[model samples]
Target: MLTLKYFFEPNVTINYPFEKGPLSPRFRGEHALRRYPTGEERCIACKLCEAICPAQAITIEAEEREDGSRRTTRYDIDMTKCIYCGFCQEACPVDAIVEGPNFEFSTETHEELLYDKEKLLENGDRWESEIAENLRSESLYR
Candidate 1:
């Protein structure tokens, strides 16, 4: 029978926790806020990301810093509301906001899905290299 044919063959399904699957170069997963090499945050509080979010998941508040630099006082992204359309990343002129290759971010509560500025920044720091590489590879065609 057709069902019995598989009994003699090896398992096609991968053990998820033990074996990882492949991902595409343009996979959009977790959101992150990047910084410049000089230790300055790349986001200039332009609010472009907030404006372009179709789902209205992004919220930003800006203020002038002591050194006369414009910066965001509050930047929050509601992950639950995000449609993962990559609009926020495209709207960012400075490449400050990016969706990193991190799909493992799962929380028990809905409140934890609401990412604050600090959480985004931390994600940025943690996945900077991967984010940069993904961006670089993606920019080659354009």
Candidate 2:
């Protein structure tokens, strides 16, 4: 019976690390900092995300600009504490923050994984193509 079952069934094991499986459109992987049309930071320091974060992993400091626009003076996401629930992304009105497709976020140090504004922006820039492709591949955003 076992031999018969094996003969009839297909291989269910995935060859991960070499042949990675596809992720769902709503998969919350990593966080990214988005940019504006003019290439400026997209976060408007609204504090909605901060308020909505159940993990309390997001830290945001704001300041008034010359144009009277409230901008984030300091923004940090403690990846160690983050549960990747996508609440921050959902709370963002301007879509400044997003949970990206890249999941290879291993780090040697705990502090290294705690992504700051610069690191988040770098991740956004590096994974922009992949993020765009993922978004385009799914109908969720449409």
| Number of clashes recorded per candidate | 0, 0
Clashes of 2: 0
User: Which pairs in model 2 have colliding backbones?
Assistant: none
Per-residue accuracy of model 1 over 58-79 as CA lDDT, tens digit each:
9999999899989998999999
**lDDT per residue as tens, model 2, 1-142:** 8899898888788888888888877777889987865789889999999999999999999999999899998989998889988889878888788889878878899889888989888878877777666656664664
Return the top candidate by lDDT.
1
Task: Report the poorest 10 consecutive residues by lDDT, candidate 2.
Answer: 133-142
TM-score versus the correct structure, for each prediction: 0.89, 0.87
Best by TM-score: 1
* Clash tally for model 1: 0
lDDT of 1 at 46: 93
